[model samples]
Target chain A: MSITGIEIRHLRYFVAVVEQRTFRAAALRLHVSQPPLTRQIQQLEDALGVKLLERSARGAEPTAAGKVFYQEARNLLTLAEQAAERTRLAGDGRLGRLDIGVFGSAVLGPIPRIVQRFRQTHPQVELVLHSLDRIGQIKALRERRLTVGFNRFFTEEPDLSWEVIQTERMVVVLPEAHPLAKRAVLSLAEISSEPLILYPRTPRPGFIDQMMRLFHQRHLTAHVSQEVDDLVTAMGLVASGFGLSLLTDSGRKLHVPGTIQVPLRKADAATVDLCVIWRRGDDSPLLAEFLQEARALRHPPPEDAEPVEKPAPRSAKRKRAPKRR
Target chain B: MSITGIEIRHLRYFVAVVEQRTFRAAALRLHVSQPPLTRQIQQLEDALGVKLLERSARGAEPTAAGKVFYQEARNLLTLAEQAAERTRLAGDGRLGRLDIGVFGSAVLGPIPRIVQRFRQTHPQVELVLHSLDRIGQIKALRERRLTVGFNRFFTEEPDLSWEVIQTERMVVVLPEAHPLAKRAVLSLAEISSEPLILYPRTPRPGFIDQMMRLFHQRHLTAHVSQEVDDLVTAMGLVASGFGLSLLTDSGRKLHVPGTIQVPLRKADAATVDLCVIWRRGDDSPLLAEFLQEARALRHPPPEDAEPVEKPAPRSAKRKRAPKRR
Candidate 1:
């Protein structure tokens, strides 16, 4: 019924039979006599309660159940090899896999730099990123399916610990030539009173409402001109003078040709914050190194910036910024 | 160069060498001799261009690459078994697998019922759900990683086609006992004046922003007290009297304890559109049946609500709905 009951030797024997086909031929191929191969197959059949192979006049054919067992056995072997390779890549604080879940916000500002640096430093880890919403990231983390997530407000996951890497004020997006573009700074009312573009509520509707309500409080509203769900599309619209939009400042780094950002005069001040989220219980050294890299990216801390200092762990990141000349 | 280059003889020889550890011992076990066993190993190695067994005086052992190749061989054998199992389960238009990607909305509706009914009717076909966002679903569908996705507006993908199954209008969310809730229906402006909870923009601000701006045209501004990226949290906020929220009648299906979804007077209408998206190029009969099952869950056609209908070709879904009653 389980792995504990199966012997690696059984797979060895099954593999033997599959290779040579004829019990006689397999015995010859193994340089072993036929009786042990027969015995091993019998033992395996008895253990599994399924006939793995049938000896036809032509040769041996795998029975239905036998085939399933073979793949499982093979996967186990592949895992074993991968484990060994991981061990070889271990001391450098890297695993053969780097299962990452990146929130859309993480791709903003210096995130691209962090990703590039991490990749160069740990070329051995097989990187897998799940572009996820905050909820999706939490669910996957709870399932032990995510190794790391770069996102906003770690959401107080029961066993997940978080570190704020950077923060930006949510900014109003407008076409550079839009009249409001020269306002220097604007409130929610000003933007809501203008043509607005936003995502409709199939999913990811929280930010749109947050921005709209900031205007609602001021007794103002936006004349929504377009409904677009893709962030890139919304940015394009804003750039193309379709309508203005709002998003975090780091996202400003993804600036399109004709768009500009103005800090909101009032609203959720930390909407643009990015945090590195990891399971609190995980103590993988590699995770620590990556976190350090995130910290280093905030170097020289911006004006009025409160560095999210957590005793700055040692970083093995490649060549930090060159010292002053 | 190919799988056919593989032979039964090599399998047997490999198994024997692994179990016996040395060609000499394997030869004894098989009652055949050592030289032929060595020849099989050599030929297998040559075909794969990798060393299989490393033999020195210490006896034979598998190299890491040898182990991985052995594992792959095992998977091929497993597929053969699954092929046979399919034959057994192939009747009644039920067999194989239906790999589906469920968008956020489907997770709330009759999807569970449809899936359960289908499973009950066809015990053989495996129904696998991959929870994905619109973009993720699109990527998976294009990559053939998912056979189907349930969502809104399956568009821009020439490789995918859509059949809208259900459409419902958006509703303004508020505490069940809020003054606005007492109104028969409120406009987007009425809701906008209150603190709103919303989804954060990932690629785009979720649809809430444009809906908010419709309020802006009326000089109504939304007071966003806090921002949340998930519907559950947004609903929770309304339930907790933290702020007002918005959702569709269908979106409100996940009723948080104190939340009420009321109609909007201005009808800043948001749509709860559910469509089934699949690769246009794939015409798997079972996919057609599953599509039928999906449509059936909303009680399809009914002579009035059929948006667009397409029938499955000759191939049956690994499982299908019960002949649509």
Candidate 2:
């Protein structure tokens, strides 16, 4: 009755005996000596308190019990083999699941395209998307709930790896009736005098830091206005003439009525990067596949281009912002 | 994609890694060095052509592929254990099937009772019943189609062993109007002078041989007026006053109208043994149980008897046919 006493070897031996229909034949098939095979069978019988085989001068045959055992043994062996195969596939990253952390704005950009491409290749993988802020994503990654995260800024963390995808030029959202709304471009000097609205005030030193750095470079102080926790609130305030707010072009996917997106003057323009972050050395195949797709979509290979062993990493330095007019 | 190289050890290692969430911890659990566990994982990955684990300073985690592998490996291991357990039970003869050979007339006596007792003790066993004559039963036993057979005549065979359960006393089946029908008992000397009928004329040297031997010993001869293929047909002829015939008491279970069974005189009575035959050394627990029940029924033990370490083997020799006047 104690299954602990039963071993894999017993199943193999029993199955061999049933298939060969004789102890001698089963022993030969299993590449073992007949006496040991016979002894093992006896041990099995003793353990189960039943007689599984009948040995006559003519040959050996399974008792009714033996036949049942033989079938179960075969099933177990097959399952074991299947487990090995499935494990290998999992290791290869061809099969499994991925839990990904996504910030709101990320869905409007490379994240969706990257996810789509990854799915096309790895349909078997289960992809779970959780909406979280940059800080929340980082915490979830450390806790192993989220395999990877896509956000608008990157911070240095030794325990985490960061890969920047694209740097988007900043634009201004203004009420359509505002005097500057008709202007094709507006310099930092002009906007510096205007009351400004900013969003996602918490998870600090993030988007605000980028804006502050831009004004600090020109020795101009940004006019303090109102700070909100979400882009929609910021846009709402702007449409009500609560001053203008800066957002990336990808945010254009969401249209707030009565608000107009305007390109900044070249000298005043600044850009923020969208990046991916994950726990450093996390080796889930799903994450790897997502990284590959994100990188490929952000920086596609040129047609008919010769292969390069390693592509040069993108520069972190911001490029000169192009003028709108 | 070639899983042939992936061994059970790899599955164990991979599962341990995922459970421990680190190769170092998995190695500790498996009692192997971390490097080998890591290498085996890599080998597993190579065989499956997938990445299964992400190893970092914090620990290791299954990639999506690794996750799938982990579940399958666990299943395989569980099945292997179950197989062993089932095999042990089969060896114990607690779980299996038995195909029994039966003759039409044998079912009227101890065979059905023996089968019922065996079933009550071994409910897990599957019992298959096949109706066969003595010759067919013997051939089926040799071909392994039957586990054991209940038959009337015992034939000598080195590959088969036989045990007599009961010897049925012979009785005369006579027509209601026959002179012997009114007698309490009749002698072979009296019956020898009257017309008689024998059944199943084929398979020479059968029950007729046994009947003839009894008559020859008495210095008498049977006047067989007709030969029929079956007992029913023989009974029909006897009902019409064609002749009288000898039958075992169990045949009385068949209610043949217009016939009467008359016990023979003590000096003239004959008996035939009903025996069980099986391939010698067949070690099915079902057969063992059946034999025990049958023997117990045939020879009920005295009340308050202590259990014997080994019940004496049944004597193979036929007993003297006791007088039954």
The most accurate candidate by DockQ is 2
Q: What is the C-alpha lDDT profile of model 1 across B1-325, one tens digit per residue?
A: 2322445446556767777888899888867788888877777665544455667798988654445455544543344344334433342235557788876656676667777887887677788999887788888988888888876555455667877767667777889788877777876655666888776443242355654555566677777777666778788878888888777666667777777777765345545567788887454545766777777766446676643436443331233233546
Model 2 per-residue lDDT tens digits across residues A1-325: 3443455577678889888888899899888899999888877666555556777787788766567767777887777566655555454454577888888667667688888878888786778899998889989999999888888887788888887777777888899888999988878777888888987787887787778788889998897598888888999999998898888877777779999988877666577787888878665545666676767865554455332112222122213235536
TM-score of each: 0.34, 0.64
Give the residue spans of candidate 2 off by over 4 A. A1-80, A89-97, A120-124, A154-161, A170-247, A252-270, A280-297, A300-325, B1-78, B88-97, B120-125, B156-161, B171-247, B251-269, B279-297, B300-325
Least lDDT summed over 10 consecutive residues: which range in candidate 1 chain B? B313-322
* CA lDDT of each prediction against the hidden true structure: 0.65, 0.75
lDDT of 2 by residue, B1-325 (tens): 2345666577778888899888888899989998888778877766666556776799987755566777787877676556556555454444577889988666677788888877887777788999998889889999999988888878788888887777788889999999889999888888998887887786676787788788889888887788788788888888989989888877788768999989887666588888888888765555666667766876654455332222233221213235637
Best by TM-score: 2
Q: Which ten residues in a row have the lowest lDDT in candidate 2 chain A?
A: A307-316
Note the B-chain TM-score for every model: 0.59, 0.69
